[model samples]
Target chain A: MNVFVVGVGLIGGSFAIDIKAAFNEAKIYGVDRSEDNLEEALSLGLIDYISNLDELDKADVVIIAIPVDATVEILPTILDKIDDNCLVFDAGSTKKKLCSTVEHHDKRRNYLAVHPIAGTEFSGPQAAIANLYRGKTNIICEVEKTAFKLQEKGMEIFSRLGMRIRYMDPSSHDKHIAYVSHLSHISSFMLGKTVIEKEKNERDIFDMAGSGFASTVRLAKSSPAMWAPIFKHNKENIIETLEEYIANLAQFKELIENDDFLAVYREMEDTNHIKTILKGIA
Target chain B: MNVFVVGVGLIGGSFAIDIKAAFNEAKIYGVDRSEDNLEEALSLGLIDYISNLDELDKADVVIIAIPVDATVEILPTILDKIDDNCLVFDAGSTKKKLCSTVEHHDKRRNYLAVHPIAGTEFSGPQAAIANLYRGKTNIICEVEKTAFKLQEKGMEIFSRLGMRIRYMDPSSHDKHIAYVSHLSHISSFMLGKTVIEKEKNERDIFDMAGSGFASTVRLAKSSPAMWAPIFKHNKENIIETLEEYIANLAQFKELIENDDFLAVYREMEDTNHIKTILKGIA
Candidate 1:
């Protein structure tokens, strides 16, 4: 099998590496706007060939693993260029907008709108890995629009990559993902920004941060190029979630100010159930 | 040596278990408000005897591992009851009030204020483990107040437990910890509350939570009884920190509302340096 991956950053680049590891006979091709990322992917042997849309003719499968904004922008052109048999898929964090954007395309049946629910706070071709997607959930939306053969081909590769496939409507995926994944990025970036502003000294932050602080602030390091568009696409839901997040923070702030020990404790105690919820999902 | 560990919940209980496990000859005694916690402690062999203030004469060392409020309220009583040669340490998060409470006590020489930077969000005796403190840093405030002999003893025990002991003033410890640990709990708890409010259904949360959300919100599951008082004691610093946090959220929220993709991306891009900082500390 041959795979042509666009963007060649963390998600695409990592997928390329992992796919080749899973299927030794597979040949991977890398495509990206950045020469450095493409070079790194090739040097790392994440790809056997590097080319642009001109080579889409011979590609067996095409993966759009770029940031959400780029994925939405370039998807239509790629769809127009792909052959009828190409198994097209995307690893975007959001789905509704991308699926809707390409819903009317001639090659729409060739695409599988997918979101593999796994990634670290890191990004770029250098951050790619062989096992980045193993044992994680891969969300597939609007599958019926995809031809049976194409969907099956994508699923077989995803299964080989060790992902658990889940099905959902694009709208539902967007709403739920806003709460679970998108809002977390916003909260983390804000938390990091807040402390950096308050401390006014990076040195102080470096000296004092413990493991808990590091884990909580981890996502603050994610690529702006990738996340900015996610927040933009999921804006309404992100804003609604943000308002709720700020309200919760304000309520806790008031409880702390009043020295309302019981209220503060009970509020935190109430949210402690997140442990069970998180553990169950993992 | 005989060690009396009061309030043997997660922190104290784990400490007791590790201490006993590492040193077979040390006699460990347990005291707690919960009969079940004490029974669990006994059944786990974390301690060798059930003792109290009435039996204070038996312990050559006393470890107060209770809520911050309780530690401030009980330290003087426990200090006055202990033998002159005995070393007493409190494994509480905040140290300002606890240290101040024992400032002029004659036996202040016997009391050491220590905060071990190790724990999970889980609580109680069942959360006790043999090696929670290994390779972690434990902060000891006002070590000069503790007599050289007892300080040496405490260091030996912590060292044998595979912990690194760093010393600082109580006032500084309280302020720095607000940024490093307590503030993290507030941010995470509020994040959990925000997601809960938005989702309005636990099932949605269960199905959608990915590893990113899990690690980011891990601190939200921490025991409120343990955290509220820590915030109460460190209120001023926490308020300043919380205000900065709110302001950061507002700034990010406005950027999202305005579609300032560059600002959104750059903010996260800048904060990503936390990866370098975390790499150094961890």
Candidate 2:
């Protein structure tokens, strides 16, 4: 099997690594706009060859792992180039836009839209690591849109990589993910911005920040190139969530200002149920 | 050496564990308003004996690890009950108010204002773990007000626990901590609240939430009893940070609403320097 992984950064590089390790016949080819990333992916042994979209016809599997905006731009072209038997999928964060981009394409059956819920605060091919998808949730959007055989092929790969699959429509995926994923990024980024602006003394943040602060702001280190497009593509849903988030913050702030300690305590106590909601999630 | 641990919860119990292991002659006496906590601490071997406030004069070292408001109410009495040679320190989140509460106490020389920047989202004696303070920062406020001998004793205990010391005035410590610690908690709690309210289906949060979402909401699981008083005591500083944070979020939301993707990208890119600032922090 020949795997063509475009945008050979963290997600793409990681998928290549796992596929190469899981299948003896899998030969990985890297395609990235950044020549430096392609070179680094090669040097890091994340790919067997550096190829371009022109050679995508030879691919048994094509994984689109670029920014969501870029995915929307090139997905139709990618679907046009792959063989009928080829299974093409994307690992973008926002699904509705990417799925809609190729809904009327001639080879719509060849493409699968997926958002694998896994990542760290780092980016680039160097940030890629093995077993990233192990025990992680992979949400598949519009599974009925893909060819049955291609869907089976995608499932086989996800199975080998230890991903649990949940099928949802593209619109619901985008809306729900706005709360669970995109909103988290914006909140983290703004939190980091607020702290960095207020505490000009970096040494103070260094000394005073505990594990809680680190955990809450960890996603601020995510790649802007990847996240900006996501925020843009899922604009309406994300804006809704940000509005809700800001309103919640403002209310909580008001409670504290009015010296309503009981209300503040109840607010946090009510949210403590998040522990049970997040139980068993990686 | 006799150690009286008031409020035998996560912080106090962990301190007892380390103190017991570090000094062979040290005896840990648990004092909690809740009998269940004292009983649990005894079963966990976090304390050698169960005692009361009246017996505090027998204490050679007193560790106050309760809520900030409770700490303010009882600090003076604890100082009065301790021997002149005894060392008393707190592990509260806010320092200015706590320091001010015992400012003019007759036994002020025996008290040391310290905030050990270490804790998990969980609480109670069952959440206690050994070595929680290893390689963590312990902020000391108004060290000069502490008696020379008692300061030496407190320093010895901190060294044994492998804690690095930082000295700041009470006001500055409270102000800086609001941005780093207190503000992070409110953001996380509000994020959790927003998501929980918007996504009524808990299964969706469980299935769709990723590592990033999990991390950004981790602090929302913190004990409400412990945090409400902290928000009250540090109201001004925390409200200031929240205003900045909410303003940043609102502006970012405006950028998204207007399709200003470039500004969103630049905003995240600029804050990426938090990576370097937070380098080496656990």
Per DockQ, the best of the predicted structures is: 2
What do the candidate models score in CA lDDT, each in turn?
Answer: 0.85, 0.93
Model 2 has a DockQ score of 0.89
- Which pairs of residues have clashing backbones in candidate 2? none
lDDT of 2 by residue, A1-282 (tens): 999999898899999999999999999999999999999999999999999999999999999999999988898888888889999999999899888778899999999999999888899999999999999999999999999999999999999999999999999998999999889999999999998887775565568888888899999999999999999899999989999999999999999889999999999999999999989887
C-alpha lDDT of residue A110 in model 1: 92
Give the TM-score, chain B only, in order for the candidates. 0.97, 0.99
Candidate number 2, chain A TM-score: 0.98
After best superposition, candidate 2 residue A194: deviation in angstroms?
0.4
Candidate 2 Cα outliers beyond 4 Å, as residue runs: none
Report the alpha-carbon TM-score of model 1 versus the true structure: 0.95
**lDDT: worst 10-residue window of model 2 chain A:** A198-207
Report lDDT (Cα) of residue B128, candidate 1. Answer: 86
Error of 2 at B174 (Å): 0.6
- Could you tell me the lDDT of residue B145 within candidate 2? 98
Please count the clashing residue pairs in each candidate, in the order shown.
1, 0
How well is each residue in B137-236 modelled by candidate 2, as lDDT tens digits? 9999999999999999999999999999999999999889998899899999999999999887556556889889999999999999999999999989
